[model samples]
Target: MPIYDYRCLECKKRFDVFMTYAEYGNKTVVCKHCNSTKVTRKIGRIRIAKSEESRLENFSDPSSLEGLEDDPVALGKMMRKMSGELGEEMPEEFDEVVNRLEAGQSPDDIEKDMPELGDDLSTGGMGGMGGGLDEDF
Candidate 1:
């Protein structure tokens, strides 16, 4: 589900709604304060934060990662298992970070000095997964 921004042409009121992709396009989103059908779609903010457990769960499961894991040791092993299943080589940096992790170094500690190591640390490292927002949340 995603939060969508909408503006009511009748009332000139802007509001947000939480709904599935299908519902977003098909449903008639009316203004909460004023019931109006003349709504226009607008881009809404996306929440990207994942809890610690959610992060771990994503790392542990190959299915969720589309098999991008390809390290023989540490998280790389898990990634490799996933990659083998998905038939793709995990990103080179992913394997490097797994090597560091296997050496018993904390990701935070490594990330402090080498920011690049933190690239794909969360989810598939698509970039900017944390909850903190640039604008006021």
Candidate 2:
């Protein structure tokens, strides 16, 4: 099945039509809101998928770690992107830590608040964050 996006000319609203390959050109699309036949197919956003090896390589690149220790916002963004690339649900603590980092909270303060964060994780040489996330992870 294919999802076709359309914009109604008369109502100026967008809608989608689901169809099989055989019924695509043979079927007529109607505006879900206005029931108008005057509609035009519109291109939609595109999403790209990468292999797991490639995603891991991107995270392993040393350049990606530049200034992340000093900049909490960038660190938070990196963490969020990593999580998204992994395409899975993260724990509540992960979300809280990322949100705090993005909100300009010092990593040291976050570490003090969340003492359960273990020291087993490695930071890949991006430490010196005032004994915060860098020291443990």
Candidate 3:
């Protein structure tokens, strides 16, 4: 048996139904709140699993990031999305930079404020994966 979500048309409330696959269409769904038979099935969000390769591939499309070099906010948004997909821990400074970008701060201004950002986040030496991305990656 599985639970299904539904909303009552008359009472405008939501409820759940439990039925076997064979009894789905054959069952009479009624609202628990008001005994309303006029209920509509509600589709919940569905999640799908994907490979890491496929996820990182999305960021490799240069066309999708057109003019990103000129827009800090857009760059920050993209970076955030990429980080989520990467599912790896990033440094606090990385978060700070992204936050600054999202705040509409120009890259030059952020860099000036955190002069060591480049040298510290350099690919050759990430704060030990705890601070930045690995060079090999």
- After superposing candidate 2 on the true structure, give the runs of residues whose Cα lies further than 4 Å from its correct spot: 1-49, 118-137
Which digits, one per residue and each the tens of the lDDT, describe model 3 over residues 1-137?
A: 89999989998777899999999999999899999899999876444477989878988877888888799999999888887787765665677888999999998898789877766666543344434545643
Clashing pairs in 1: 67-82, 69-79, 69-80, 70-79, 70-80, 71-76, 71-77
Highest TM-score among the candidates is held by which one?
A: 3
Candidate 2 TM-score, true structure as reference: 0.49
What is the lDDT ranking, best to worst? Answer: 3, 2, 1
lDDT, candidate 2, 77-136, per-residue tens? 998898777765555467788999999887888878876554423332122222233343
Q: All candidates' lDDT scores?
A: 0.57, 0.76, 0.80
User: Tens digit of lDDT per residue, candidate 1, span 29-135?
Assistant: 78887887778886533344656565455447545544232422355455444444443344435555666766656656657766754554443442332323224
Which 10 consecutive positions of candidate 3 have the poorest summed lDDT? 124-133
Ranking by TM-score: 3, 2, 1
List per-candidate RMSD values in Å. 15.3, 11.9, 12.4
Question: Best-fitting candidate, measured by lDDT?
Answer: 3
Candidate 2: worst 10 consecutive residues by lDDT?
124-133
Q: Candidate 1: deviation at residue 64, Å?
A: 51
TM-score of each: 0.31, 0.49, 0.53
